[model samples]
Target: MVIKPKSLLKNKALNKWNLFWLISGPISIFMIINLLAVDTSTGAGISEMIQFSVRWAVPFVYLVIATSSVQILFPGPFSRWLMRNRKYIGLCFAVAMAWQALFIFIMSYFFHEYYYSDVYYFRDEIEGSIGYIFLPAMVLTSFNFGSKLLTPKQWKLLHTSGIYFLWAYPFSVYWWNLYYYENPVLIDYVFYWVGFVAFALRIVAWGKQRYELSKRIDPNYKTPIESKMLGGLFIIFGLLVSASGLYWQDLITSLFTCFSMVRRT
Candidate 1:
């Protein structure tokens, strides 16, 4: 009996978990507020504050949670759901980004705070140069409507390129920080490094699958074991270097303070 997947999502426990993610907004908000409160009191740098609050403490976690949930809960049906519903996700991201623009505008104008103007520009230039390109490419490939418009080979190339862009952003950020002299922290570390893991996994899977592919060797592959191992080690080193960039003590201290007070109450 092929139990319909959507029917399974209706199970009480599964429904609760879905509701949990939905309701987690409040908890995330509170956590961010607490983080901001402590940072403000402690005089943390604006960039570090924003990075911790938005990138690390919130959006990245949300991204991982949402993607992981779709994969685990929906599986096969998830693909169809994503294809049918990706526009909604894109639209939501667009709307959130638009709201961020509005917020930045208000901050720069009404509040007379221009500190983040360059930060905004830096992030925009990087993401537009990279993330924007991939997202559109993925949207095009994953959409049945767009896929039909491109030849399979063309779509495959574009889709593969998009995946590449997705992986490249972290390295771009690393270099961007060096170029701009901006410091990154653990959250930034995790975001980029975790992404590297995904990228490395894909490469490993491809290489393993093509180990004896006599009729179909990847032109990109090198036959040398040393090169392959070196590439793997580079991925590990990147993660560690990125992780080393984090503001760990500050985060741990603030988090512990918050929990300790709660426990005392």
Candidate 2:
């Protein structure tokens, strides 16, 4: 039996449960390794584990946020796979966060003084608590049994808002890493651009869709030349914000702060 590569991709590559564990299993294993490897003797050790788990989680969330937009902008097999497994990808994120939550509990309970003094910030705590609340709700609704409990609109509302809330956590962290911190690491810049492109793709896709819909609704409808020129300018301006982070640092920092993730360690 000869298997064609293309046929294999369509027929069996990344089928649901396989894809889920394929991503989630490794993430879980790494968290376990961190548990064993890191010195659990101090709250500082637990904090490193929390940071490790967070790095694993953020990329999956970003992929979920960008999935649909990727399909819209560039229709292809890779994008289609992402669309199909968006739920599983999100579940992978949940698995990673679960590890972070476990470490958080260990810190808060066992190393109360260290947790309170070094790590605790009231605004960050509030945001993180809200994120945890949404996390389980999203995981529950990802399955049909829990989803059956909500109307279609209700389900949509929960997931949409939850995704944005999750995205904001890391986006703000990296935002500050680049602009607000004295000495930012290389990984910080990598994450900041990856996230910037993810959200930017969605915005560009939205504008494309709005134009297409307007044209379809009324054949006579024509976007003015001024609007077209303004669209180009908007793209350039957004790029400028990315390139010249220092100029807009203060305002962007203040705005993104205290919302979902006001402050990040």
Candidate 3:
């Protein structure tokens, strides 16, 4: 098949998004479980169940739809169809973020102390840390204040550092939970391993992109076939990660549900 440039770029974007979910989705699930199942309930147990279910289920469903829409609207085989629906995709992401913020507030205050205690722990650790400070920095830069107040280099630095911190938060939470509970579960190990793998791949990708730029800086430079080879390797890796993440998500959810059931009974 003749691969058009646009098609290739589109595929690359989808692959990136796929890898992103692989890294991010599991953390989302873990948070959802902690927010709903392990968290204390008030009113009727059924009411707690309903609230928890909505908070957990709806966000993921919206995430799937939004990310898929991003894949479709931005590029890939379905770009044309996706372009027509791009507004909906953006709206979905906005809605998802809103839902996420709501949970953050609920999980921070309304529930048992353990949930917010974790948040405060992170806040304390993250406030003074070097590379870790970027997560908040990036969120700041993404808004108008950073754009207007910070220099270009400062903004770039904030975003670059922020990306790594955002990725690290999930695994950090898992490890903290494990240490606190004194039980190292499979999911803990999975989070650490998969999160590191994802982070490593990201660093590698950044390096490769830099190498490509350096090569291009030379007047005689021609793009190497090795670039395509690297891309192909990443594509394969992306698929595997996506599949593994989905499988683990189901497994984790089931385990958490079982534990929650046992707790009540």
Say which candidate scores most in lDDT. Answer: 2
| Prediction RMSDs, each to the true structure | 13.1, 4.4, 13.1
Tens digits of per-residue lDDT, candidate 1, 145-262, equal 8888889899878755654554465455543453335565555555555555544555555555565473365656556888778878987886665555444545765899999999
State, as a TM-score between 0 and 1, how close model 1 is to the true structure: 0.46
**Candidates' C-alpha lDDT:** 0.51, 0.88, 0.50
Q: After superposition, how far is residue 125 of candidate 2 from its true place, in Å?
A: 0.8
Cα-based TM-score, every candidate: 0.46, 0.88, 0.39
What tens-digit string does per-residue lDDT give for candidate 2 at 135-210? 9999999999999999999999999999989988888888877887789998898888998899998998898799
Residue ranges of candidate 1 with Cα displaced over 4 Å: 1-117, 120-130, 174-183, 212-265
Worst 10 residues of 2 by lDDT: 5-14
> How many residue pairs in model 1 have overlapping backbones?
2
Among these predictions, the greatest TM-score belongs to 2
Q: How well is each residue in 136-250 modelled by candidate 3, as lDDT tens digits?
A: 4544455586688899888766655554444444545554544444666675666555555545554555555676687879857765799879877987896575445634655
lDDT of 2 at 176: 77
CA lDDT for candidate 2 = 0.88
Candidate number with the higher lDDT (2 or 3): 2
